[model samples]
Target: MKISTETRMGRNRRNPREERSSFLILCEGPTEKGYFTGMRSRRGPQLDVDIPKGDHISAVREAVSRVSAEYDAVWCVLDTELDKMLTASMLRAAQGSSVELGLSTPSFEFWLILHHAKYTKPFQSADDAKKMLKKISPFWSEGNTRFSDFADKVDSAYARAQQISPDGKNPMLNPSTSVWRLVASIQGRPEAIGRSTGAGRS
Candidate 1:
């Protein structure tokens, strides 16, 4: 995909000759691909969201290898429960590479649940998170969930995620996710952390 060199609206507004940061988002599943593909930024970095064929590790490795000078950041969106061994291997491989991880523990549904309310309880598996998520969003279907349903609540979710995990580390921890950190980066609002609504319930 070609990178957009045109300046965006807010902080990214600069002379036409100025360069914009390009981003590559590699997702683990169709749901992640669909969600991130809808993300738009008027002033933030340009993004290319993709879901490559193969396991998460191999996909991530492929994505990392594709990160050339044309892209400034390459983010891999993964679910911790999909493949623990592969996830670990991918993390190890990302050590020296430019690839960054946006991981969700148990499943990516945990991140989506945060959009509605705070849920700190540890989920047994991705299915567990999905079951709980259906309670809040009856329309949610794995790999079919739409981004438009919760796009407006992204900030709320991000704040709740920070409240639950301030440092944004350790995806092995139940109910922990660093997806918000990536969203904040895409939005160019690193300082937008810690603003919570306190509406989340256990």
Candidate 2:
């Protein structure tokens, strides 16, 4: 049997600039926003991240309202400490829409903690998670958290999250997080890492 040229070259290859996946990330707060912004800065041209003003429940609402074909994906990065009923309603609204929610138990700080340590202890609140993070990562402070702090440790964090929650389907699991799902999605793309070309998630 003769092999076809398309098969040998791989039929999936395309122009990164033209087919680049664009994402609209609506974060719950400054910390979440800053981390994703840093991700945008580090991702290759194959990915584009657009973060607009909106947070927490507002972010979920914005994501629901802004569901359009303009962007490939709409993500809402939020914490679970907000009003349970309100968050549930917004989450219901997101159903059947393009909006994908990345929820961290208590707060996004829990996800950060995974970067420094493998912790499965449940947090009482965002403040509690922040306190724990401070103990291990003194660099993280209110309004001062940067992506560079955890840039090199992204893989470690992802692995830790997986260990905590392998399925990664629940947003309400205490001491569990879904942020790794979003990060893994981005890292899976070809040439997704901005710092290096052709970097693949390991």
Question: Per-residue lDDT of 42-88 in model 1, one digit per residue for the tens?
Answer: 65567798888888678777877887987766788888784567557
lDDT scores in order: 0.76, 0.70
The reply for model 1, stretches above 4 Å from the true place, is 1-19, 41-44, 82-84, 192-202
Compose the digit string of candidate 2's lDDT tens values, residues 147-175. Answer: 88899999999889888877556666787
> Which pairs clash in the backbone of model 1?
118-200
Model 2 residue pairs with clashes: 28-56
Write down the worst ten-residue block by lDDT for model 1.
Answer: 193-202
Give the TM-score of each candidate. 0.81, 0.77
List, in order, the clash count of every candidate structure. Answer: 1, 1
